[model samples]
Target: MARGPAATPNPTVAARDGMVLPAAGPGTGTPLAVRGLTVSYGENPAVFSVDADFPPAAMSAIVGPNGAGKSTFLKASLGVIPRLAGEVDVFGKPVEQARARIAYVPQRASVDWDFPTTVIDVVKMGLYREVGLLGRLSGARSTRAMRCLDRVGMADFAHRQIGQLSGGQQQRVFLARALAQDADLYLLDEPFAGVDAATERAIIDVLRDLKAEGRAIVAVHHDLSTVPAYFDHVFLINVRRIAEGPVATTFTPETLQATYGGRLAATHLDELAITGGA
Candidate 1:
């Protein structure tokens, strides 16, 4: 999972597939793309003129140090943040036109874990589009939601109150909600941030399954160590587009130094971890 070089914002291939998974049927080479994207708060710009393309049926990791605008970029793509001057397209359509095919798993801190909701209620909430306004539930909806819970190993906890679950279990419930969405593109912000190794592996497996099915999965990741092994592509961002490409090339020490500045040196341990070393 350790990376090699650093370069301009472009994409490359790593670990091509021989037998394609049924979920991903050779998605339209370019499923998501952005040009001159910028997001800001009040008078400050979080992202600036960044342009990048994400391939269909691939796993793309959006990475950077704190305040690097990785999550902002994802939000921008989804139209959550205000864009200065840019365009976002999904599955060959403008973002708004393709909203139904998009799913989002915000950072854990963004959710109200103590909202007094049951696991089944939370998972079923994701079926909003299918349920329309009345919030009605059919036998099929319940069945699918249960299957999604099972996929995340949460079927046993299906009836438990979400507030009582552990941090990792809460994260899995969010993932299960996204799974219930059954969309084409998934945007996850720090799904592994506070998770244990086992939860991380379980989340990774879910992501792998999504990519295999040809669903584009983009995660805003802070752990530089796991990018190489877990993602096919990465966008090394920091207020500006630092580098974008395969993890093998975009995650070099030079790039890390550029984005993290003084903190780059602190990541020596990260470099070692990426390379299978101590």
Candidate 2:
């Protein structure tokens, strides 16, 4: 949804049924928030009434079955796609006004890996917002880009064409690009998909470092087993948000069953014990 100026907090309303809507108040530690966020494709609604907060220094995962509107939420929130109804805020401000502080890494499948671009070139693209379209990445910007690549273990492949790299290598390169953006709030779409174990570990480490820096990271994750281990918070969804909170409390067996509609077998729930899904 295209947003206007930041809206004032609805003073007449506070918490509804003891639930804190994504409105800002004194000491609301949330950095990214969505209220009544809805999106549709033709006559079909993809997302419905998603209201939540991306708290500071937290790694939150949006988990659900395929076609659950996981990708649609991210795109709609970022204004990359039109929404049926919603409001997105960053640090108590509207998303459009806070675009500079937000960085988005779309799913690898959404990108054209065959595009003719070098690793460094792709990484440098992150700095284009800071540097003008015609601006060059000289001095500090160049240093930052290279440092980001190094962090993702892709510094050695800076000169290689992106299409020539392996799936994991390409994911790492794209992650490096997001790191180079140096934004406070990151909205990633399946950062772990199609990546090797080592790359997944590296990406998780990077997410931890970002959390340490007081940044908020939200990713659309598919692996139920790793959801508890990887994310501090989880949002269980199926077209609409089912439950969202700290992993320990919110990721229960009943909740998972509700989210997945009992599609998860008993053995599968038992194995996801860490997620409290047993």
Clashes per model (N, Cα, C within 3 A): 4, 0
TM-score of each: 0.86, 0.88
| Candidate 1 clashing pairs, residues 3+ apart or interchain | 1-229, 23-213, 24-213, 24-214
lDDT of each: 0.84, 0.86
Off by over 4 Å in 1: 1-29, 266-278
Model 2 residue runs over 4 Å out of place are 1-29, 274-278
What local lDDT does model 1 show for residue 76? 88
Summarize candidate 2's per-residue lDDT along 102-134 as a digit string, tens digits.
Answer: 889988888888899899999998897799877
Alpha-carbon deviation at 86 in model 2, angstroms: 0.6
